[model samples]
Target: MRTRFTWGLTVNIMPPDYELRLKIVKNKIAGHEVSKLIAPEVLEYIANNCENDVRHLEGAINRLYAVTAMYSPKEINLEFAKDALKDYIGSSVYITNNIQKIQKAVAEYYDLTVESLKSKKRTAIINHARQVAIYLCKMTTEETLDKIGLEFNRDHATVIHACDKIGESLKKDEELREEINKIKDKIMN
Candidate 1:
């Protein structure tokens, strides 16, 4: 008896265009082919072990666009369509760095370190600075609760609580918001 292979069985094959697009993205990002940057075995491993879903491929492409936007050459006006994929997934690093920078500026302005701000030992000045730092970090960082916890040496739950408290305060505290804006401007400049 002869067995027939279903159409579904043949659909796993990737088109040449998809492979070429992957190569172009890889080269643009890394100045090399994906195969050159990652080992052939590793590539094969990902191809074999991972889901062959179009969504997954699309996600990867989006991530590339995000990285490009974050680190794009200053002179280039990153074409919108070319970068739409990246914008969709969004970015954590960009948010994290902006937060970190703002935190650093606020700390410097108040003459404190981020560690000191996060610490439980708080005078009035320390408490205020800490609150500001928490607010800015929340506003600026795409850091998840777990990542923010690691940054402040707190548990994720604590980070969430801090964010909630600070967010509430920011809504009512116009003076504090103004100060934070000034500091952000300085740091961004």
Candidate 2:
């Protein structure tokens, strides 16, 4: 059997602008029968963060509603909006660093095994890679100085010294600084 079909015109729904985004959120909340008054600042915050996608804007509203459903009629303010969409907020740290993640990325970049990178061998190559890894761990992670030191099998003072060395190297060694920044971008991105 053969069937002939004609395609209909497509409509592209571009993301709403700031004021329109605020209206959309307000309308969605009202549609849900949520009577709580959302502060203008809260709407503006969501609008700014979720502007590129209408789905993101709606998801933000859903997140807020889901988190605060039990406290119906409670006004959604700036802090509440921030807390609801913490992951999407620019100020929030989205990439949580782990020692293993750092070690793997650095080792891969240096073409060394993670075991070799973490070992006691002090070859110039491995040592340099290890120091870079340690510095990245300090910069990207919230791990304690001692904790990072433990992962690298070094003392906290050693980790501190490596961080200082890398920091100073970054100040004067332009090529090395760029290389390190590239590594950091790889880690975070």
Candidate 3:
């Protein structure tokens, strides 16, 4: 003789919708105190690309944070996200070119753009960062100065100068040596 506890209206619990998934990821980021670390663009990327399991969002954000920490990139963007979360995103070579990877590491280290590094910007900061990137590309890869220069929108002369300048500077400038090492670290790992 069961009493009046019958089910009135059955309510089916479904997987979270898109907005909720986004909110869940965001809340997880906040909970991890890494809201400031993650880029807004990556939030949407996570929402769009992550599997149906919403818990994966938090794990993704955490993993992203850890990976970026090693590289110490300034701004985490879509390309970086795609590369860092390749396990989740699949084995696509978003950053296939070795030159591109060097440029990305150098740019992120200096908080500059690859385009700006390639441009004719002669400001002190941009110039130094460009030289550093050029040096790294030359040192790390077998690509000729002509090829590296083409990537940076310059000729072999510019690549040669950058290599000489940064190379000379590294001899005396301990800070520059450290910076270069950091950029290289990002590039390698």
lDDT of 3 by residue, 1-189 (tens): 234545465587776644566677778778654457677656755754553577667777878988887897777865577678768544222223389998998899989988999999899999998998887776555466789999999898988788778756654687886687577557658
What CA RMSD would candidate 1 show?
17.8
What would the TM-scores of all predictions be?
Answer: 0.46, 0.51, 0.49
Tens-place lDDT per residue, model 2, 67-112, is: 7776664677656666666765544232266899889888988889
Which candidate, 1 or 3, would have the higher TM-score against the true structure?
3
Query: Each model's number of backbone clashes?
Result: 1, 0, 0
Off by over 4 Å in 2: 1-95
The lDDT of each candidate is 0.51, 0.70, 0.72
* Candidate structures ordered by TM-score, highest first: 2, 3, 1
Candidate 3 clashing pairs, residues 3+ apart or interchain: none
Which of candidates 2 and 3 reaches a greater lDDT? 3
- Residue 47, model 3: lDDT of 58
Best by lDDT: 3
